[model samples]
Target: MASRKSGKPASAKPAQPTAPKYLDAKRGVANWTQATEWLRVRGIEDIECITPDFAGVARGKMMPSSKFTSNTSLSLPSAVFRHTISGEYPEETGDFRYDPLDGDLKLVPDLSTLSVVPWETDPTAQVICDMVTTKGEPVSYTPRNVLKKVVELYTARGWKPVVAPEIEFYLVAQHEDPDYPLKPPRGRSGRTITGGQSYSIAGVNEFDELVDDIYDFSDKQGLEIDTLIHEEGPAQLEINLRHGDPVELADQVFMFKRTIREAALKHGMYATFMAKPMQQYAGSAMHIHQSVVDAKSGKNVFSKADGEPSEAFFHFIGGMQHYVPRALVMMAPYVNSYRRLTPDMACPVNNAWGYDNRTTAFRVPHSEPVARRVENRLPSSDANSYLALAASLACGYLGMVNGLVPSDPAYKTVNEGSVDLPRGLLEALSLLEGEPAFAEMFGQEFINTYVGVKRGEFETFMQVISPWEREFLLLNV
Candidate 1:
């Protein structure tokens, strides 16, 4: 396994076990007896029981396949919920959600996510888990649980939300030193990317081995990736996932990122989903295409019989316009994410909706009535996929429920540099802190804990002095 920041292989740490409460919570857990037998028959030795932390990083225990039985108990520290991106716990204050005892939470494995590790030398299988209390109640703050709750909102209304992600990332030379700058690695053509090559076929074929490996692993993991393309930035590529259930898509993305990173490692390169990994190039984005369909009729809810947009579509756009500004904390989760939000970067700067327009944050593509959908271009590649989709759908869900109407579309317009989006993580955090929708959609306790961790990160970042300061200010001032 590798640390998110360093991209270097990290030594495996032993799991510290907590006493299990021995409660049979079978709601999230599936019938794993057959799955366990399947793994055993395939000679799988290690089973990685994984869970996504607040930062969206995979963290969990690796146990022998033989140890995975009906009585298997997986418990982790409750403090894991409050861990920062750097894998450290910030000081707690006020009336915090977690008690001073720092008790354990049960991790129930999701049997459906079980798959073989294609890259690992050892025969290994991995399964995603959900965090739960001793009494079998879901931890509301968990990203997967939050998404499930939001999906229930649409389910209750006889509608189903669908999402497809266009995730952009960059391939760089593997650099061991954290301070060293990363450059593009040589592709199949024996040449490194030198300039922007948007939509260039040669650019994509340049790294044929890496691309092929990505597709291979994605298929092996049952990730239905639709397409891959050379994006605007040098060494940047975009992978579009097939549209499906929102929760399934989020789970795919969560695994896809790790799979890509591991594939890059095997190729002696590094793949980064960080929004602005390079100062000179455009930022990476995770643009999610969404639409709603009738649960029973299976008709597009955003379209009408005559092929025109419906009132629900307008309200959905209106909800996005009303709520996107406050949801920036989830869309652009890190300080680096803001660097990609500038007007000139081809990223959306406003919540304006438009028909077949890329400038607006909400873009309605030209599609048949059944395929009618809106593309939200605000979220960065660095965001947690589950939370981003949940926040986005929640906003639109509220709009449909409240009968809100959107403003005029910003059709074929350029960035006027007048949008009022928060320009930094700190500003976004402040907006989210005061917004009631955030508390309503994502639990109040979760919001408070997330804000606290982000605040600590921002404070820590402020204490550092960058090379730019020394280079420009050391002698001049």
Candidate 2:
């Protein structure tokens, strides 16, 4: 399965580092022509030029293959960058970026991301695009570009970062009512999960059909899924992707979520990446395993020659501890996201590091020198992969460049002595705004827009009354 992910279209891989003339608009239209021919041979008639928004939702335009091949550029409203999670425009804020007068932004398709839509009957290909102004500057808030900037920072230092993401989600029976609690979907064995079964083979076999189909679709889409394990939650499951380049890994994570959801809908069940879908069960997380390697030698830089830890490794951990609180907005991006970050939720509530200690936010796994890595348990499954990876890598990069030292490992447990992270969305957002390192790393323009948009989401969430409130406070108040 891991080998399948490296099968890229011939166009994606080049002997040289720089993009070829075929991709440049000024050079020639040959690449577009070649791409059109390539799709035509594969029975694809349409192309969707997609860009991930601030909320990590796919947004873009669909065009016929002929138009896509002929057009030199695609135009989408710049306001799409500022749209909130509810699909609402933050017009009330009056920020120039959110104003109604927003105009067009150019969409540059990343030809390398082109993949066939296995779920669509008519044969469509989708490629992720990068948003840029007509003058050619990358849009500050574009999630992919934001990630690319961080990757570039590593490239400049002759280093490469590899990441593997473990994503957890739930399979539930679809319910139409907004107030109703979700129930586990019945498996092919005619039974709904009633007990916690962490790593139970019988538990995984209950939904064997669904699990088989997920693997089938994942392979069809070139996702390099490595392992599947039944989690402690009733119907919750976790999938692990093999470690690879950060940007490529993020793309796979993004596509894998969509594929899982669509496959679930087809089977009359629903899959949610919600951080805390069930009140009684453990929350879901997108735990990331990261390691830095020397670009030239292709060797792990976190380990020394005699198998001792490297200075870079300690600095990386220090950076993560120093910066994770400020990057919480991207790690746990929604109101429900904070619900998963409680003290005993098996979620990391602080920046403490430990050697194989699940209680800490960052854990140094036991591995060979060549495979030494740090596992970040901070991000929820609901996070935008691009932003989350970018923020995580940026923190480690800062630590490496500045030579910061990490605090002593939490050899005991989280209960002994660990600092608590922000307790809620509002608090996390406030922390993000107050952190100077984050503002300087991500830029003020992005910070302001992201805060404004997410603040609106938080405000909108407060307007809705929940069943818990009514049940507990309606008569008492």
Candidate 3:
């Protein structure tokens, strides 16, 4: 995969002295007063009030810092959640109807999420907001609220779920035409990457200047990146986030996507989170490593006093194996997402659980008793972070509560001819709608709306003619 000539690297900006103080204040800003003080101290000129829609796209308003007070009201149409990726709403969404008046939902900012927008030319801040109804009730169908609902379930049971997400994405050259395929961007060497460079330090150094900006931006935003490494595709990289609360981690992932894209653009490159951006190369994925802990004791529930795997561990796996097939639509939302699940692409096609085996959908990584956890490898980078984490945890929660049993761990390769998962977007949506358990956990209304949105996207995708059909089916069929 060759690319066009690289653009001149942008000069790094000087770090602000207030950046460290802003990062420290993010942890202690619990109310509007403290939030206002933090912004005032940082000399914030603008504030971005944003929330993640069903597609994980940032949707909300931007305002001058002086006008963004505690009493300031922000809203968006409820219909934003119903819109598909192609900006089209399905005319007929079964069992779910759009309000004729198109009601508005209030945006209540989560003050803890406030951080500096490091890449912005001016002193700007951003905060993630939660949507609520006119009556001050939470909108249960919203992605963030859905995740919060699941987290509350764990809280009710005196358990806390921890997650560490490893997000993989590709760096491609800037392209204008949608008809042309993406190619790896040229690095400092002024040469295009030709093949896979897994874990190659030299390969990573090719784009060291860009990576430095990513690190600097993340630091200013108070996002912690545990590690960064090259993956098995040309110009592909992965960043692992430190394990913490599910909702907090999801918020970080949501912000990190925008931060990465902004950082890439500064270097005249495009950072793509598409599941399968190029053919004949490994696809991007968002692998979630999760574990449950006792809320009071702060101990891993997956391990027993004897340092052996507990029943809860196996039950969690069992829950995933049973429900992930049905929850595929949440983890793999886009039509292009399915292209990454092929057997040859080093992606899991089945929900087989195993010990440190990448071929299985759920792998129990080798860790000390305190860190015993299961890694769910199904979610694509294109998935909504909030929904994907919610679905995964919900499944595990059901497993623990219902005492589900898992099959014996797979000792050999289980990637080949494993057709246990849905093969297409339509199939995945059907499976999701047919499963009542998900509807109960994620809410029936949310399920209906999600299925409707996905159906609309799939229908739109079907209307387009691909090159394969023009080449092979134009005359042969």
Whose TM-score is higher: candidate 1's or candidate 3's?
3
* Candidate 1 lowest-lDDT run of ten: 20-29
Q: Is 1 or 3 the stronger prediction by lDDT?
A: 3
User: Model 2 misses residue 65 by how many Å?
Assistant: 1.4
Each model's C-alpha lDDT? 0.85, 0.84, 0.91
For every model shown, what is its TM-score relative to the native structure? 0.91, 0.91, 0.94
| lDDT digits (tens) for residues 1-477 of candidate 1 | 898987866886678985322212211224666675567566879988998876789988999988876568899888887877876676765424555788888998888777777888899888899989888899887888888888998999999999999999999988788676678888877778865799999999898898889988877666778999999988899999999999889989899999999989889999999999888888999999999999999999999999988999999999988988888888898888998998877788888889899988899999999999999999999999988999899889889998988998876675666756899999998888788866777888778887888776776777778889989999998
Sequence-dependent TM-score of model 1: 0.91
Estimate the lDDT of model 1. 0.85
RMSD in order of candidates:
12.2, 8.5, 10.6
Can you write out model 2's per-residue Cα lDDT over 1-477, one digit (the tens) per residue?
234667655456456686534333211133566677567666778888888888778888998888888875898987787777888876445342664567789999877677777778898878888889989899877788888888888999999999999999999998899688889988878888865788989888988878888887777666778999999998889999999999888888888898899888888999999999988888899999999999999989999999999999999999999988888888899999988988776777889999999989999999999999999998999999999999899999999998999999998778434448877888888888888877657777787888888888987898899989999999998
C-alpha displacement of 308 in model 2, angstroms?
A: 0.8
